[model samples]
Target: MRGVSLIILVIFFCGASSATAQFYQTTTAHVSFYSSAPVEDIEAVSTEGISVINADNGTISFKVKMRSFQFEKGLMQEHFNENYVESEIYPHATFKGEFLEKIDLQITGSQENTIKGTFTVHGVSKEREIPVILNVLDGGQRINLSANFQVACEAHKIKIPKILWKNIAEIIEVNVNADFQFISK
Candidate 1:
């Protein structure tokens, strides 16, 4: 519930207005990560991500529960929560920022934009500028956003044991896909 509340607070902080607000939101944003290593490849996906975008001003926020990620192997999932990310201490990863380019809510096609913001993971926050491909759909009533980025585990203080160094990659690939529907404030 804290995650949900945080998203709501983000929306309100965007200065939503009752008469002219243009908020698009969803609780099912898709977020995934991949790690390629010499010994093994690791991947996980979480469809339980929450996001809110103020289309009027291009304000955006995204949050995903760390434990919500599902891995193919039970052991990998356990290690992810208990070892890598330490889900008990840092329960969620979040991004908050605004689009660098002005948003055109009426655009019928796709647009390339860059979002600069702070990405928090494993209790560490880093400023990032990520490129995104956004498609306006349903006559501007829906927006689909996709982005791919890389993160260094060491930068976030996620340590890899010496024995497991070969099993995990130093850098991880992250992918985000989210579809948000326009909702009136």
Candidate 2:
């Protein structure tokens, strides 16, 4: 019957639409970096980071303004923006990559996965694989992400004066945390 065929077609389209998961996004993701040495302790935090995640395919991207990083000491911040990172010249840092493990919106749990992507900072780009934890929070409606990684100063072409070598470390520890909510587009 034509009625029966029409009913089946409507149901099929409804089911197909529900199969794909919604995209998640956040604007105030937090990112921090810490560098410690015997001569000085350096650290900064930036709460202006932005991130987007594709729940269907596990694709992720992030961007943060270099000048948004806040340091404890004013002199340190000035030196960092001028002599070290040159924030005036390179104003932003970004990452684009995908998770190795697939994310299922129907499930609610945490998965440890590696994200391989290109990281661009201070006008230099490098390929990196970072370990991260993805959690399906709030009954699969929200996603929580956290990652800790090390970035080498030389990799980003950040120059440190020889006199200040004792004050700054060669490698910096970066921390990222974000809670994303599903956004229907």
Candidate 3:
């Protein structure tokens, strides 16, 4: 009887470890952009972004459309879509990357890591390294990621008119906040 109980305990532990490796989650990630100038500051917000997060492996992927961004003023939004971003042509921006290898979330309480990935915008793709702060909660079952990065308008082929050059900055700062829930598949 003792030998049979020991064998059952070992089998249970092995199955538990394998089950922990396949956890996944999905969330509605929100992103916002802010432009600052000496005269005024403009802000735009977008919530129609989707994120697929793997809690067990700490991998994140997100997608957002250019048209989903909303600005404070309608005229500025129109100009942004028509002349600058050309949203009608290039519809979406995507990021695909994983955290630096071997930074396991199981051991770390809270981690500040860099996510290096390729970001595609306005039909242009560029390699960007974003500084991310992640909070591991509920024994690594929930993850909250926050980051801020600057995007150059010219790099993505966004052209600012001479009349509005001083109003809009050359680079825009983008902020992201995402919270994910665990999903078992």
Clash pairs, candidate 3, are none
Q: 57-176 in candidate 3: lDDT tens per residue?
A: 545566777778898899878877888778899877777666674445575466888877778888899988888887777876677778999999899888877777678998999999
Model 2 lDDT at residue 16: 30
Scanning candidate 3 in windows of ten residues, the lowest lDDT window is 5-14
Say which prediction, candidate 2 or candidate 3, comes out ahead on TM-score: 2
lDDT head-to-head 1 vs 3, winner: 1
Per-residue lDDT for 13 in model 3? 22
Give one digit per residue, the lDDT tens place, for model 1 in 100-131: 99878778889999999989999999999999
Return the TM-score for candidate 2, rounded to 2 decimals: 0.87
lDDT of prediction 2: 0.81
Give each model a TM-score.
0.94, 0.87, 0.80
**What's model 2's lDDT at 2?**
27
Model 1 stretches with alpha carbons more than 4 Å out = 2-7, 11-13, 16-18
Error of 2 at 36 (Å): 0.8
lDDT top scorer: 1
Q: After superposition on all CA atoms, how large is the RMSD of candidate 3? A: 10.9
Clashes of 1: 0
Q: Would you give me the overall lDDT of model 3?
A: 0.71
